[model samples]
Target: MGSNYLLSPYSLKGLQLKNRIVMAPMCQYSVMEKDGKPNDWHHVHYVSRAVGGTGLIIMEMTDVEPDGRITDYDLGLWSDEHIPAFARIIDGVHRYGAKIGIQIAHAGRKAEDAPEPVAPSAIPFPGPEYKLPRALTTDEVREMVRKFADAARRAVQAGVDTIELHGAHGYLIHQFHSPLTNRREDAYGQDLARFGVEVIEAVKAQLPPDMPLFFRISAVEYADGGYGIDHAIQLCKAYQAAGVDAFHVSSGGEGPAGERKPGNYPGYQVPFARSIRQALNVPVVAVGMLEDPALAESVVGNGDAELVAIARGLLRDPYWATHAAYALRSEEKHVPQQYERAYH
Candidate 1:
């Protein structure tokens, strides 16, 4: 493949994506009044991106439990009532020739500003205003696993083509993987990978056999002795064996503010995805600061990753895929008919 690769179609477990560029899941925080239901705003927001020519639109992280939400306004998939709202959004996206995937997560100890947060340990986030999360009992941990499965089932019922497990971002799942947060002797906590493995298994059991499943993993915690790129490769291999379709490699979030890396440039995290892809046979999606269309295309062309996901860049211009297609000189890309007058 050349550096200026053309956008093309791809498939994941029977779900056909019209192109390689994907709109990464971004927190809209515009849910309907804490009910975690999508309303007209979400429909307009996501549908606009789809119509603007994104191949796949990964919806924002939706909490599997109410208290698991990152913010009170974040979306939720824990209840049957959320199905109708999501169904509308999915339907709208499909109409524009785009496939939609929902990213489901449990915020765990990182759940701040919510009514309550749960985690493997009671250790609170180090921030001054961070609230201490209640450590979950064995039974509670089991229940959280069930919540993830139930949420996946709900997403399927709502007509989503794929479901993504939000296991990164120092959330509940990442907490279990990080030695800094998960310090417990229980079965779920004794082994750092145990919690995440169980959650993936549970969610897989509930989803349809043909439904594509993806896991978003923090490729590096960026903290001393924290989960590193090598550990992430191991986790990717484990989940691929467990039947995950792809891995979304991301980094950062483990201990405190000092743990984060500043001065990020374009394609800063591409190496994480490349390393994971090289280590494991599973497909990988590269994210982070992938603003330029040509740079995003080079990631796939150079074998850095199988898919390129853009968040803020896509938000700045939803027609990024169309522009990327033009840059690559690929006529197969889907540019909305309405935008034809402007682009032509």
Candidate 2:
């Protein structure tokens, strides 16, 4: 494995990444206070990846409102008080030379701590712990779009290099985008792309023109009667038109237990990433069980994706990128000077 595309520099808008290896956002659910502010756990978790040589570190799904969180333990940006704490973490990651991004999201029908979760339809998530969601009025939906904009503004003020909207994993934006969850008869129903498009427009307004925007999407649902790749391509095109600069292609969080599960092999979602990149003509990130450096390299080398994200792999080894640079025979400069001798 030669030092190939995986270790190459990539720039989108004004953001420049040192390598194509990104630390995908994975929630810690460790917001010690019930107020949704990040704590020490998040700081160490992200900064460690920065020091390990990851090019971009996307923070976990941070909620826009108190009740919009997946759980009370999730991070948030609902108030100005939350700014300083996030700025501290961002500064730490930057100190180690890695750019940071935050995924802004709302849990919607899946909001575990909401007195009553809200959704486009009054459906219940298929689980005992989950409650039936109250359908949102058109006005409420518009308000949600506003909340997303405010959250993005707060994140920008906190000094993140980029903002990723968590439009996947059956969250609020995903709920509005999916036919299964968004059964509304009005504008959202007729146009599946309405909510997402509005959300993107709002977020972009709050960001500087040069700050790249990333959207994570479930490219294809895995259940019966669900949408497929074609639908995803169409939705992505709509999003791109709205304001997204890149797509983080992932799949299958909308289905029930036994359905079309995506392959578990390393780089299984690379094809989906490739399709989205080609169809939408934007940079895309391929993630999903890509623990092997060789496989990650191949995804980039084959032009399947511009970046590769490793989740559980990075959790198991924060230095996964540094080790990968070694495994791929990357330039010695990728290894931090103090730790360079250990690699040999």
Pairs in steric clash, model 1: none
TM-score of 2: 0.98
Q: lDDT per model, in order?
A: 0.84, 0.91
Model 1 lDDT per residue over 1-344, tens place: 22335377788777888888888999998876889998899999999888888888999999998889888889999899889999999999999999999999988877776666788899887786678888999998888889998999999999998889987888988888778788889997667788788888988998888888999998888666676777778777777777688999888776643555632798888988888888886788999988687888788889898889989989899787877777777766577676678877
Top model number, TM-score? 2
Highest lDDT scorer:
2
What would the TM-scores of all predictions be? 0.95, 0.98
Q: Lowest lDDT 10-mer window, candidate 1?
A: 254-263
- CA displacement after TM-score superposition, residue 19 of candidate 2 (Å): 0.3
